[model samples]
Target: MAADDNENWEDRPLIMPFCGQSCWLVYQTLERALGRSVIIEPGLSWTLVRRQDPNMEHLAKITKCNTMVVLAEKLIEESFDPIVDRHTRNNMIQSVVYNCGSNFPRTNFSRFYTAILENDGRVISAASLRIPSPEIAEIPFIATSEAWRRKGMCRKLLEAIESALGDIGIKRIVIPSSTEMLAKWQIKFGFVNVDYQTNKNIKELNTLMFLKTTRLQKVINPITRKTADLNFLPPSSPRLPPAPPSGQ
Candidate 1:
C-alpha cells in the first residue's frame, strides 16, 4: 500500500474511486496485511469491486473518463507522490480505471478485480479478472503499455493476484486463451489446456467464457503455488451387483 494513501483513509465507509468500492478502511494488523492492501506504491497493486457496493455510480463516473488510461490519472492526469500533500480523499492505493479486452465488456464491471502498475500516476500495465463461481476465477484480460512491455509488469501483477485470490479461499484460476498462445501460456504461466469435456464439467465456466477461446487453468495454493491438471470429472458410480448376476 502507498504510504501517503494509507494515512488518509478515514475510519468510515469512505468511497475509493480508484479502488472502485465504498468499503471500510482496513486498519487492523492481520486483516490489512492479508487483503488487497498488500501491494505498494509506484509498482504492483490491485483494486476490487464486489457485487453490490454502494459506490457503483461513483465507479461508473470515474471509469467512464478516458483521462487516466495510463500511469496514474487522479481525475486530471497528475501523479501525486505525496497524497498527504494534496487535499484528495484518503485511499489505500490509488489506481485509475482500466477495463478492456474480449470478455470485459460482457461481464458486470461491478464485479471485476484489477491489478495495476503505475508510474508517476499513469497506469503502465494492468490486468483484470472476475469470480463467476467459487470453483474457478477467470482472467479475461491483461495489457501493458507498449513502452512498458517486457519489463515483467504483467508477471508481477499475475503473481500478486494469485496470492490475493488464494487468501480469499479461491484455489483455481483460469484464462481464456488463443490457440497460438496455448503452449506459451503453459510454459510461462504453469497453465494447461482445459479439455472440452472438463470445461463443460465446470458449468459456470461456460457462462463467462467467450466463444472460440481455449480455456487454460492453474492451481496456486497460496502457500504452495503448486501446479495441477484439471479435475472436474463426476464421481464414478458403483457397478450394480454385476448386472444382477447375469439376469438371474
Candidate 2:
C-alpha cells in the first residue's frame, strides 16, 4: 500500500526504531496516504547476549599482534561503512549505513566497539566492535577494514574484546545480526544459535535476527507467601484528619 495509507491501518505492524506505529511518522504518513486504518498489535523486540570470542587458536600463530583497544565511546561517530563497503561497494555501504543510522532509535546506541590492530607494534587495520546491550552481552561485532580481512586482524580484535569482557566478569554475549556468511563464521567460532527472532521489525522493510551465543544460568524460586511484599511499602506515617472539618 501507499506510504500515507499507514495511519488508518490500526493493524499497522510494528517497525524498527519504534515499537508501534503510534510513534512512527512514516507509518502514520503511509496510513494517511492510503486511507487504511491501523490496529495496534502485539510485537516487541527481545534483548539477547553472549560472551565474546577469544580466538586463542589464531592469536597463537601471530607473532606481532599488539592489542590496542578502543571502546564504544571512542568509535561512536565512525560508521560501519568500511566493512560494509568491503562486502558491498562503497556506494551501497554508504546508503545502507545512512539508512541504518537514520532508522534506528537514538536509545539503541549504547553498546559499541572499535579495535585497532598492531603488528610488530605498528597499526594494521581499522576495526569496529559493538555490544548491543548490557543485559545481552553475548555477541560483539569485529569488523576489519577490507584490506585487513584475511590477515588474522579480525581474530586478534575478537580476542581483545573477549579478554576485555572476561576481565569484567562478562561470560556470555548475544549478537543481533543474521546473514549466511555471519552464520558460517559463528559456527566456526562455536556460537550456538538460539534461533529466536523477536516480533520487532522495521515495519515491513526489515526483520531483526537474534543469535544467542551464551546461555546464562536462570534461577527459579517458588513464591508461597501471598502477603503483598512489604519491601515495596513506604515508611510508617500517621495521617491526621482534615483539621476537624475546618474548625467546625
lDDT of 2 by residue, 89-168 (tens): 43322232122243243312222223344344333443333323221233333344444457665554444444443332
Regions of candidate 2 where Cα sits further than 4 Å from its true position: 1-111, 120-127, 130-135, 138-141, 176-178, 195-248
Off by over 4 Å in 1: 1-46, 49-110, 195-198, 226-248
lDDT against the true structure, each candidate? 0.46, 0.31
Which residue pairs in candidate 1 collide?
1-39, 70-122, 70-123, 71-121, 71-122, 71-123, 72-121, 72-122, 72-123
lDDT of 1 by residue, 48-154 (tens): 32222225645653442233333332321232222221223433123213332233323324434454555554566655565544446677666667677778766
Whole-model alpha-carbon lDDT for candidate 1: 0.46
Q: Give the TM-score of candidate 1.
A: 0.52
lDDT of 2 at 160: 43
